[model samples]
Target: MQSSTKTPTAGGRAAPAPWALVSVLAANMLVDALEVSANLVALPAVGAGLGLPVPQLQWIVSGFAAGFGGLLLLGGRLVEHLGRRRVYLAALLVFAAASLAGALTDSAALLTATRVVKGFCVALTAPTGLAIITSAVPEGPARRRAVSLYSFFGAAGFCSGLLLAGLLTAAGWRWTLAFPAPVALLLLAAGARLVPRDAPGTRAPRGPGWHATAGGLGLTGAVLLLVYGLSHLAGPGREPARAAAAFAGAVPLGALFVAAERRSPRPLVPPVLLRHAPLLRSALGAAALNGSYVGFLLVATLHLAGSGRSPWQTALAFLPAAAPLALSALHSARIAVRLGPARAVAAGAVLAPLGYALYPRAPGADPGPAGLLPATACVGAAFVLAFTALHLQATGSVPAGLQAAAGGLYQTFVQVGAALTAAPVAALYTVGRGPALWLVTAVGAAGACVALGGLAHRGRPRARARP
Candidate 1:
């Protein structure tokens, strides 16, 4: 790609802030994050307006996760082959079109289809955006700052969606679906201007071989089946047999994919990469961060709405979590530098479970700020520490060429973790909120243990054997 250099002005003065490229990238991150949570608060209204049955309504959310998570590996490869700038811009255009279609469609099926399309577009763009940032920015404080800001925008987007959903759903659910269009278009225009073009003499790489292609397709199918089954677990028409079938079908598919990968000339995911300890750990940490956070939000939102609180009130209650999360993200890079990313992640792990544990102690209906504040704050802190650290840890070790794939792998875990935890947590809520909170607590504790082990191991210097 074209290098981000200082373009001279008419007066022979250099342009201000080479970091403007990061702004374009962060905007993409913001839009991607916005899509994840915006439809959440608007779901009830969407169901009513579209006259969708409760079971089908759940698909509106799960569909996106399925498409995004399932295709991320392939999407990453596409970025590698086709070029980052090309893939990113094209994805934005597709996203805008899908958003427009979603807004205008009256058919629930068509709208749901649009969500999946938009999600696939996000799968392409999100990792590519990160890849671009890492490639463009020099590693160290500048890259760290860029990643932190990028992550902050994502967290902020989720919070913004919660509030925006309340307002837009009040006007009409369509507004929530349509909001991304204009924002995406503006980003597209700015991106065309600011984003450096592909390097001269660089042609798109050839596609993967048959074995790799087969493995990728099979793996994507397995993931989709798994996510689909998990999402159905807590729905109104809970069908154990169907869910079981889907889960069962995924096993052989996944195994076959692994087998195929072993034989492929050029596997979509390099086998050696899988053995990278830091990358694996970061993937696990990403999963834990998202699973616990989304699980907690799902339960908390349900509790508030069930207690006769309005949508606005429920959204407001979540402000404690969002506000602290934003602030923590802003400063997390500094914390990581001081404590080390592993230790920072471990610290987050501890806080997350502690937060979940506190939630169960909150008194009867409408547990005021006094009860919820500590729990939300802890969760927020966990997010800031874990999310930023994991992003750095996952990408820091990878070579330049594989950075896009690394980003894809990291994000795939995130979506899978969120989807997997959400259903079980929703089911637990039916039993009791206490059970749900306890489950989250257990998960957090486990994640913390992993992080701590990594920290202790990293701290100890390697001993040399006597010659």
Candidate 2:
């Protein structure tokens, strides 16, 4: 792989500083991560401001996941065809515009539309950013370090967003909605100046054949249906029949998608990619990590709300959990070298469930931050260890050309896992917080087992680089 340190200049002058490229990409990641959690804290305020019911308000969150997860494969394909730098800049422009529109609009429908648009833009930008990093940074230690830094920035971004949400919501929920616009605009400007242009002589891929087109359509439909059904599973005015129908519809579409991909000349997801055990393991680990974390967040938020904690207090309560994320992510490259990636991931997998288990053991109602500290710390540690390790594993396993696709696939698993687990956990929360916490524990344990098993098989040959 080429070193990310230097790119050819327009007039054969010196390359832009490496720090400039890193800053632009990391800032882009921060903006994306901020969107995931910032609005979460402001949900109640937004609902009150827009006179929206809880069911409708929840869509503001789910709509983003649906658009992000559903179109990820297509986004990856676009990155390949349209060029990474081109897609990245275009997506940032759309994201900035959407953030402004979302803040200005009073209509809930318009706000939701903006969320979906931003989500779609994120689908393009996130993976492409990763691809750009992989393309610029050579494989081995430097790339590992770059990936670690990238993951650290993402974790820090999520933490920052949670804190920002509370501060912004105090002024007005719209402030939280509008915050990303300026950040995105700044990143876009910086990115245009610093980000490397596409390699010379690179051209767009040919149009997809009929089978590839069919498979892509089917896969997109399946993902949308699946996410929509899962999001509504525990929602107010829940419709079991609709959820069931949506899920049932998805199965056949998914089956057809697989069949069509097998026959396509230019498949969206190549069959060989499925056989890559390391990538698959990393993807599963990522899914489990994200799903359980989001589930915990949902239950914890509900518990805090029930305890009559203010939004600010609730955000503050999560501060302890976010602290370890950056520390762990930054040092994960060294940890992976010492313990091996699979073992490090396994350790994190075990730690997360242990943390979730603590939640159920807390004495009485309103356990407070003091009671929550141990569990929150463990959860944060798990994110620090697992996310950085899994990111390195997945991205390292893929070839240069397919880095964006791998990133999209990895991120799709993340969003889908969160959506899938959130529904059941949210449903269980209606019964009791204890049950939901236990469910998260059980899921985390399962993921730990998978990670441990992968560790035992670490002798498997690494994937060969593609031409």
lDDT per prediction? 0.75, 0.77
Model 1 residue runs over 4 Å out of place are: 1-21, 48-58, 104-112, 133-149, 232-236, 360-364, 395-404, 430-432, 460-467
For model 2 the local lDDT of residue 169 reads 84
The list of candidate 2 runs beyond 4 A from truth reads: 1-15, 51-57, 106-110, 134-149, 205-217, 232-236, 360-364, 393-407, 456-467
Top model by TM-score, which number? 2
Tens digit of per-residue lDDT, candidate 1, span 128-203:
7876787777789888778777878877888888888778877898998999999999999988877766666564
lDDT of 2 by residue, 1-467 (tens): 34345566678888876656776898888889889788877877787789875545655676676668766777766676778898899999999999999999999889977877888898888778877888876788877777766777887888888889889988999999999999898998998987788997664665445676677667767866775576556646467888899999999989988898787776777666777777788888788888888778777876776677767877888877776776566776777768778877888898999988887445366658778888898998887677778877777767878775576677777776776666667666655677778888887887788788778878876656462
lDDT for position 216 in model 2: 60
Global local distance difference test of model 2: 0.77
Cα-based lDDT at residue 216, candidate 1: 62
